[model samples]
Target: MRFIIEVLLSGLAIFLAALILPDSAASVDGFGWAILAGLIIAFVNATIGTVLRFFTFPLNILTLGLISFIITVLMVQLTSYLMGSRFDVANFWWAAVFAIVVAVIQMLLDGIFGAKPRD
Candidate 1:
């Protein structure tokens, strides 16, 4: 139940982020594609993303957390690759932008829906 709601919210965030991007930085074919992309991203993040983050933790510390952000951008690229034509990010730099945009939108949505921060 909670997972389903989160997926929907993520899809909305993706859709809005795609629309918000300028100069063709990113695009989503439609709401359905956005939903599917959201699901795929969530799955990958829970699996491969976690391992990647764990392994990169040392480098992340050395880079002042910049490596974590690079990992995020790479994940966005991977998500776009996995989704093929339906969801597209122009490049690594654009993927970074898209990731940031989606994250911001998701955070806003979570706040709007009364999600409280964990202590």
Candidate 2:
């Protein structure tokens, strides 16, 4: 249930970001593809992101977690490529912007939902 909610929220965020970002196009299918893409991205990030973060822990620490931004961009690019859809983003900068927007929205949602346990 929580996973589904997260994916839906992410899809909404991506759709919103697509509207704001330049040269970024998403389908007009009422966010169906966006929802699917968001789910795929979440799965990939949860599984692959964990391993990548573990391996790059030293760099992550040195960069003060900035490397995660790069990872997010890569994940978006990977998702776009895998989808093979017309939802094209112009370049890496736009991709970065999209990632940042999605991250901010997701963070806000996560905060509101309090999915993570307090320390």
Which candidate leads the pack in lDDT?
A: 1
In model 1, how large is the Cα lDDT of residue 7?
Answer: 81
Residue range 23-80, candidate 1, lDDT tens digits: 4799999999999999888788778888998998989899998987887788888999
List, residue by residue over 7-34, the lDDT tens digit for candidate 2. Answer: 7888887777777665543331347877
Look at candidate 1 and tell me the lDDT of residue 93.
91
Model 2 weakest lDDT span, ten residues long: 21-30
- For all predicted structures, in order, the TM-scores are 0.90, 0.79
RMSD of each: 2.0, 3.0
What lDDT would each prediction earn against the true structure?
A: 0.88, 0.73
TM-score of 1: 0.90
The candidate maximizing TM-score is: 1
Off by over 4 Å in 1: 116-119
